[model samples]
Target: MLRVGVLVSGGGTNLQAILDAMDQGKITNAEVAAVISNNPGAYALERARNHGIPAECISPKDFPDRASFNEALVAKVDSYDLDLVVLAGFLVKIPEAMIAKYRNKIINIHPSLIPSFCGVGYYGLKVHEAALARGVKLTGATVHFVDEGMDSGPILLQKAVEVKPGDTPELLQRRVMEEAEWVILPRAIDMIANGQI
Candidate 1:
């Protein structure tokens, strides 16, 4: 089985989806080896614990620099002998060194289509708010390979959610998240597993 490590910074809704998919045999030949978070209080940790997966925190504040924190983070990920690393709602920008180490093996789920409303300081509710403000008829998620650049990786998969005329940010966010959890993430993982990505 391909051992996978997940990183998260908030409530683990996406992580939960991946866990459910794994439990249901939707993601063949893969197992979640560990979950790591930068925020000690992130609910993703709780989700990982509930699944009996090893969960850990490596706060960026505790490290002297990005490089040092990344070193420890890379070590933790390596300890799992991971075949893939999934960033599920993880908010920090991983250092270039760590990105170089993992390269194509790291994947991230972005809240919007790439080259669009993405990059530094764009995540979670902010993404949805931007999409709504832009009068976009459609908005969704992107699952892409992680590179050193901020959300500027090669795209793996994308799922679109229609933006209704009267949609609130909360409603659009919920819809996009549903597509992300049930569609985009699974397809991306399957593509990787099948050597299609």
Candidate 2:
């Protein structure tokens, strides 16, 4: 089985989708071995607990520097025998060391189509807001490999959603998330498993 690890910093909606996909056999050879979060109160940890999956918290504040924190995080991931690391909603800027360690083994799901409303300081509802302000006719989610640059990794998959007139950020977010959790994420995982990535 391909052991997967997830990192999250908020509600585990995407993590839940992954679990559902696993339960339905939509992802054939992967299992989430652990879920790690920087915040102890993040609900993603609770979601993992509820599913009987091991969960952990490793805060950057606990370490002296970014490198130290990343070293600890990498250690925790390694303990789980993780083959792939999925960043669902993790907020931290991953250290270059970690990127070097995991390389293409790490993947992240972004709220926007990327290279548009992505990069530092663009996350969550902020991405949707930027897209709306630009009067974009279409916007969606992207799943990409994790690299040293911010959200500049090679795209694994992308799903587009039509931007409706008079759409609120909330509405667009809801629609984008639906496609993200159901389609883009699963397809990316399948590609990795099948060596098509």
Candidate 3:
């Protein structure tokens, strides 16, 4: 089985989708071994606890510096002996050392079709806001391998969601998450877990 460690920084709706997929047998040959978040208040941790999955908080705020925090984060990830790491709305920039260690073993779920509203300064609702401001007719989500660069990894899967007329950023964000993010993220995880990637 593929042991996965999930990193999150928010409500973990994507994480929940993954868990739900696993529960419904949509994903095979894998199991979530642990969940970690930078925010102690993150509901992702709570979700993990409810599922009886090991959860931890290793925030940069708890460390003296970024380096120390990175080291600790790496140590925490290593402790799980994970086969894969998924960033499900994890807001923190991964340490270069961790990226090197995990290499292609790490993947992320971006809010938009990458190479579009992705890269630096684009995340969460900001991505949807940009899409709305640009008056895009279509927006989507992407699952991709994580590299040293910002959202510049090789794409694995993508699914587009429509941008409707008079849609606000928040509404579009929700639609993208429900229609695209929630769907493809789990599919990507299943693909990776089953060695189809």
Candidate No. with top lDDT: 3
Q: Lowest-scoring 10 consecutive residues by lDDT in candidate 1?
A: 179-188
> Where does model 1 exceed 4 Å of error?
none
Model 1, position 55, has a per-residue lDDT of 99
lDDT of each: 0.87, 0.88, 0.95
RMSD (Cα, Å) of candidate 1? 1.2
- The C-alpha TM-scores of every prediction are 0.95, 0.95, 0.99
lDDT of 1 by residue, 1-197 (tens): 67889999999998888888878877877788999999999999999999999999999899998888988888888888888999999888887777888889999998887777999889889998999899988788999999978899999888778888889888888888886545788667767776777
Better of 2 and 3 by TM-score: 3
- The sequence of per-residue lDDT tens digits that candidate 3 reaches over residues 32-62 is 9999999999999999999999999999999
Sort the candidates on lDDT, descending order: 3, 2, 1
Question: Given candidate 3, what's the lDDT at residue 131?
Answer: 95
Model 2 stretches astray by more than 4 angstroms? none
